[model samples]
Target: MSQAKVDNYKKSKANRQKIMKREKIMHRLEMVCIALVCVVFVGWIGYSVYAKIDRAQGTAQETVEFDASAVQNYVSGLTQD
Candidate 1:
């Protein structure tokens, strides 16, 4: 049992650098993926809010009243001529 443990320890020691390098690469990749997901989520939320506000403003503009009396008078004058 002791001999097996020693053999395992030596093998691990020999491959330690490779294992550590792989772990470092994996950690960086994980952080990048997390940051990408957060950016996408925030962008989606911002767009939705912008779209909602734009829609509200559009409706408000559509409901506004404008004076057409000048246009009506112009047309009436043209017809009389």
Candidate 2:
């Protein structure tokens, strides 16, 4: 082969290799981004569930200390509005 043709072939091969490296790097970055998103999604779900459970556990029922009939009479008067 001529010197010019040999040089052209080498240049083409080098360009192909460069493109492959760039693509590989992009693929790795894409995987990392996907992993980060998945982690955030899971953490949000976990926090939501934890907050729901915490709220349910924190609220406790209490016994009423006043007379119900007296309260009912006051409520009836307020309902006149």
Candidate 3:
């Protein structure tokens, strides 16, 4: 091999442990970040579904009665002036 290639290989070998340790730490950090994102996504979907169910169950269905004679009396009173 060339002299320069041999020297480069020796230098990389000397720091191989340090490089491997750094790579391991980076891989673990990446996995933790991915897990955190998945948890937040699942939580958001759960909250949305819970809110929709709550809204549906909390509303009361009622019938409103309209008074036409009351409205006609009010209009007539306004027109009296």
Note each model's CA RMSD in angstroms.
4.9, 6.6, 7.2
lDDT for 44 in candidate 3 is 100
Each prediction's number of clashing residue pairs:
0, 0, 0
lDDT of 2 by residue, 1-81 (tens): 999999999998979988899999999999999999999999999999999998997786567787799889999999997
Candidate 1, residues 4-41, lDDT tens digits: the string is 99999999999999999999999999999999999999
In angstroms, the error of model 2 at 8 is 10
TM-score rank, highest first?
Answer: 1, 3, 2
Best by TM-score: 1
TM-score for all predictions?
0.73, 0.59, 0.71
> Which residue window of length 10 is worst by lDDT in model 2?
58-67
Q: Give the Cα error of residue 81 in candidate 2, in Å.
A: 70
| lDDT (Cα atoms) of all candidates against the true structure | 0.97, 0.93, 0.96
In candidate 3, clashing pairs total 0
**Clash pairs for candidate 1:** none
Model 2 residue runs over 4 Å out of place are: 1-12, 61-81
**lDDT for each residue of candidate 3 in 34-78, tens digit (9 for 90 to 100):** 999999999999999999998887796567998799899999999
User: Which scores better on lDDT, 1 or 2?
Assistant: 1
